[model samples]
Target: MKKSISKVLLAAVTSAVMLSSCSKTPDESRYIPKTAGVVVDLNAKQLTTKLVTNGITMDKLFEATQSKDTSNEVMKAWKDAENSGIDMQSHFFASFVFQGQPAEHKSYISLTASLKDADKFEAYLKKNIANFSLKTQNDFKYIWEEKQHAVIGWNKSAVIYISAVDPSNLEKYNPGGSSSPDYGDPSEPMIDSATAVTDSAMAIPAALTTAEDDAQIKTWVAEVDHLFHLKKDETAGSIEPFAKLLKEDADAGIFVNPEAIYNSGQFTMIPANVKKLMEGSFYTGTVNFENGKIVFNGHSYMGKELAAIYKKYGKKEIDMDMLNKYPSQNITGFISYAFDFRMIGDIVKATGMDGMVNLMMGKSGLSMDDVLNAFEGQLTYVASDFAITKKESPYFPGEFTEKPDAKWIFSLKVGNKDAFNKIMTSPMLKEVFTREGDHYTVVNPMAAATMPAMSINEKFVTLGSDSALLQEYLGGKGHIKLPDGIEGKIKGSMLGGYVDLEKVTAVIPEDKMDEDEKPVAKKAKELLKDVTFVSKADGGDVQHGEAVLTFKNKDQNSLVQLINLGTEAAKVMQARKAKEKAYEDSLFAAPVDTTVVAPQ
Candidate 1:
């Protein structure tokens, strides 16, 4: 029982997070309060939005480090960074390298970022990078683009020189060696006789929030809202369906102010860490939220175009006022709205037998996320049932599940082959399924992904809580299967009857126990004897891991002194041997016999 429950709980969480064959809250009201001031800065290794004076916030700082702004003084000094040669749109990965030594008075730090999309993603990147340059004047050029690059060299402190022009004097003053005119691979060879910084100066980003910062973030939020429009409507083809709620005698007061989210005055820019939380940083749209509506207005550059395409395929505009009324005598208007209206009613309406079927699905007491997720999981199911209409149900999986242990399994499916394949191939869908977080979202077909949609769709999104809506539609066998007093316990989360935990736990028979039966459990107990279940919820397995970095650091000054004293100290002796081996390898035919080993 416990094992089954554990699997059920975990699968439930995964299924809920992923799309399912369920209805989710169509409203965005409840989610807004959660976003307030929650900025997770991923680069800094911090998971928070609280502004600190000393630290930098990537949400605002990346643009500064990514772009060339003369107004900033520290940035102006770092000329190469101004034109780091990497395109911002295409730059998504950051490579970190630690160079040189601290005691030798030569230290360096560099971060490289990239933005490559789809197939051969990295090779496409390598071909686009630039040659590395090291000048005798303590200058370096690491630009990956055509021509222009940067070089750094240091004597007292590090000095970096950047050149768009070959004749620029920045690389003229030699520091380490004779000059090399070659512009070859940056990593191929450190152009012999080329300059080295003999010194170091590290670069860091500027400040985090400024006063002007607040204004810009607000503008960003507003722009996200405008593109995703919301239609204030509930058209369940049968006015008779909402009979109880719409009747003159019944207590059907409209829930006009469904919910007002984002009114908390607690809001902050989306966190830099949001990317790390996602399975992949790449996403389909720019997401934000308004009062009652959570808007995914699409990417600023791609939102309008993508949404227009969806609209073109999914809907045609119609008379908004004629949406919800009982038995409207106008047959022409009704049919027009049915075909011409946005495909929204296709998702959540009470019109016709199908809408009633869906309405029953929504009000079945399953949480909205779970319902929507089932659909996402079985897109094949929905598409198969609704789209192209395949002939049969698997009723059973055909691949791996039937075998005792197998390599494959069939998941749910929707028959919309095109949409089905698109989802299957999407990195975003993989992310939505495997990566955990508040990542999966659904939107109204007609409603724009904006704040206004919040007010309009609030009722639909928050339907899980509206017992009244469910109650109004309940009539036939599909209405609900509640026992005598089950309706009273529905909110209490009783599955079907008046059972409680006390009565449930009483039925645990010793013979039915699996925990003591599985040997793996015995071995797990031994392994977990010292290891902690670091993050257990509901008495479940814990997740934990550790990191380790080990390196050998030797003081070369001791070797230098011994050499000057004409004495072979153990350290100097070792250094000489190491240096000899390095030289031998530098001129080697093959040093496969020499292996790099970790210290014991």
Candidate 2:
């Protein structure tokens, strides 16, 4: 009975050990602070798999980039990293933290990654880097690179790198304070020299020296250590949306705190009212690499004020009728958007900047309301029939050169006829445009020669590169037929865009291209198919969007295609450089024309 009990206990212990070994480790993102203004997470394992599947090994990439020198520091570091015991299969995180008062603002850049063997990494660093030393404090070991103002710290599980600027040094350079510089005008109050000097003196700090740098490095080291010991609540993982984005199995993910970034000292020149607009807003996005296309999915959460405004106006779908009226069937590209113009007025008023905006426009006898109310908020810009034609050079008579030409139409739906008339008749525009029936024309000869034909009415205001095309559009003589896929995306979207890269490339004069540019252009044409983007309000305060870049080969991954293109481009560039070098060498080797004619 005792022998049987011992065998069962040993078996249970073996099973527990196996279970522990098989469990997955946590990502490095848990170490990033919630206050980080921006965070970027890279799925190293996913990226590596994609590259490998695409036949893009690091050795091949280095070869393509002409990094043949093994002695290169970057190469050496990369080789060392391979053996450093860092977990290359886990997610890596980079974060930017913006904190502190405007007068003494601090910015911290942090990079975090999981570790397999901390001691091996330390040894690798010491072997590859000069003047490297490690210090121990509590639970973590750290090293500071004084010149870079960066501190690298690590424990048994993960490594963190923190770098920051000394705010004192920033204060020394920006002695005029965070406020905008006073550009004195007769209408505005002038700041006397004595007052200016006092303000500048107060804003400026003592000069920065080696001692201050040392202190800053020490602070960074503590910051690194603190990051390693952060509580779960203090981490970015606590942000619900950001955490969800990380779990979406994307190739990469990004999170941005607009309020924190805009409030940073770097943007001190921005008006307080403008900065308030970004408060409480955050943005998150995910990037995925799939077969045939690369996609970016994004979401924006607006502030309370902005959300209220958005909710009030709601979303306006793009007008298919207006887009269909475009005069050409061979359309190359287009950008269509539907939004309520009144939202701009509301936002300006909400930010309490309407008074200043009206004050600036008062000189022209126009108000912000007059400008915002004139548009119905649906706009479409279409370019078609792109071609490269030989035209007589304006500067050199009788000389012809290739010039790109395309027919384009820019149309905007009219909201209120009276408001539109008010803007057209405003003091600033009255002298520039002349009314002919329901349409307007440029009064200046130079402007008329360059500007497209414009027609305005209660329904729409349209500008066309060709007058006939403009008349046809107004008369409803043409119809635009978009691809079913593109039409479906744009039909109900608040914002949508499409570009036919293949068509654009077909119009280029390949004969005119330089020797070095031809191969790259050819490769690009072979790889690129088309690009499309669409965005819409998800609901309430959130906006969701996607942009896709599709490639020609549907079987291969888009990333692989891109890598192949890059490698081909690199080869072309190297050949060009070699040829140029040969020419240069031949020039040097050739004997000088010493037996030249006495007179030219």
Candidate 3:
């Protein structure tokens, strides 16, 4: 009867152990420290779903990339990941943490993930790694790879991997001192191992030489411990904006702390005052892969002082009338911006650097105010009618070559005409350009021939590549009608840009391209459609921006299209290489003419 009781007790203990190992872990974001300089989060379930929906699998990817070796370590590891006992559907987080002082500074990288079965994970590691061992310390178990300067620690439900460099291996932080090592002359005799050791002993302090190898390992283990034991308030989830960004159901998200990054010891050259200004500033961004396009949305939050400056100046709207006046109706691309120039002067004065700027400008008979006041802070650059055509070479007359040509115009709204005239007629610029009626003309004949025509007036200053186009614009005889998709976005944005990829690809001159290049160009033209971006200030301290890269296929996911394009391009490259090799081999295999010839 006693023997039967012993057997039952053992079985109960085994069951408890199994149950503990299978418990679910907390959210991955909880392991990221609030002060982490940079954090990248990946929603594995969303990514996997998208891949599966697109008919993309690991085996397919390997085949596409032409990886036929199944016995390789990478392939073996990938196969093991299928049932490695780690939760594949949960989120994964990678974070960068900067800690310690300048003298003993250390940067730590940590990757946190959930576990499905701890015992199975351990077994998986043992099977993959040679001579692997697990060491238990306090409340968790860990593995230290001394050569890799990394440590992996795990609890019952989660795993954390931390890697850091030993501070002793880094050079001592000596202010205003040269730290370059003395390698001596390369021609000098090599030292024996005994001599080298003796010299090293003399050069390095005893304390450094005697430091334990496991000191960095201990620190990394401590970091792992801290991650697993973080309080609710200490995690990145506590940051309101970052938390909201993650909750937006994005495939991936990123959070950056500029204050923490600039204040780190690695950036010691940044002034303390500048670092202070960066305090409380952070940025959050999200990425989504959608049908026909990839979209990126981001928000930037400024600190109190910067926010005050921005609010004081307020936001400026782009001058649609000025942009509409662009002479080209077939524009391939354009970028427009609206911002108050005076805000730059205000910021310089606030930072106490205006005096130095004015002193430098005083030599040119101009003040910082004169330069900043010349523009009303609205500008547009447009490029249209891109073409590749054959033209006679200037250096070698009658020799024709293919060259790319485009019509481009750049214009800026005039703020104070008097300030503009003062800058234009300054001693520095007066020698190169001469005032001609209502505009300025290049004085040098060579420059006049190559440079674009410049026209200036009280309302606007414009430069154009074609003389007729410039005259048409100045006469108000031309008006631009933007595409419907781009017009809506550009009209509502303070900063806007558009690129017509179809127009660009149409002018590539595919008939003149090499056989290998033709396929890639054709694929690119089929895959790309257009690109557009919009950015605006949200009235307070927050700013928002978004960009979209659209593809030709409206029904397929952009990620899948990109993968297919990459695979096809790789195949073309492989074929090209094989063709070149065959030609080389043919030359070597040809029979040589062995007939003897008499000298003449």
TM-score of each: 0.16, 0.83, 0.82
lDDT assessment of candidate 2 = 0.71
1-600 in candidate 2: lDDT tens per residue?
A: 001111111222221121100112246777888888898776667766877876776656655655344224334334445567677666767788887754553677777777889888778656533345668999988766443346778889887877664333444323254532332221111122223323433343323336876677777877787788789899877877777777777777789987766666666667887677766778999888788998999999887778988889877899887788886778888999999999999988977889999999998898999988889899999888888878997889999987788888899998878888888888999999878887666889898887778887667888998998888887887888676689888779999999988887777666767777897888887787788999999888889999998888989888777777877777776676667767777677767973423211
Which residue pairs does candidate 2 place in steric collision? Answer: none
Taking the tens digit of each residue's C-alpha lDDT, what string does model 3 give over 1-600? 011111111222221121100112237778888878888766666666676698976557545544233224333334555466667666667787776654674677677777889887777656543335678877888876433346778878877777663233444222222542232222221122223323433454323423465576677787888888899899888887778777787777789987766666667767666676667788999888788998999999988877887889788878877677777779888899998898788778766778899998886889999988999999988888888878998899999988888888888999989998898899878888788788777789998788787787667888998888878777876888677868788786789999988888877777767777888888888888888988999768888989998888999888777777877776676566567767767667667854433221
Q: List the residue pairs that clash in candidate 3.
A: none
Point out where model 2 deviates above 4 Å: 1-26, 67-77, 101-105, 165-210, 265-277, 441-449, 513-517, 582-600
Ten residues in sequence with the least summed lDDT for candidate 2: 1-10
- Model 1: weakest 10-residue lDDT segment is 378-387
Residue 103 local lDDT, model 1: 32
Q: What TM-score number comes out for model 2? A: 0.83
Candidate order, TM-score descending: 2, 3, 1
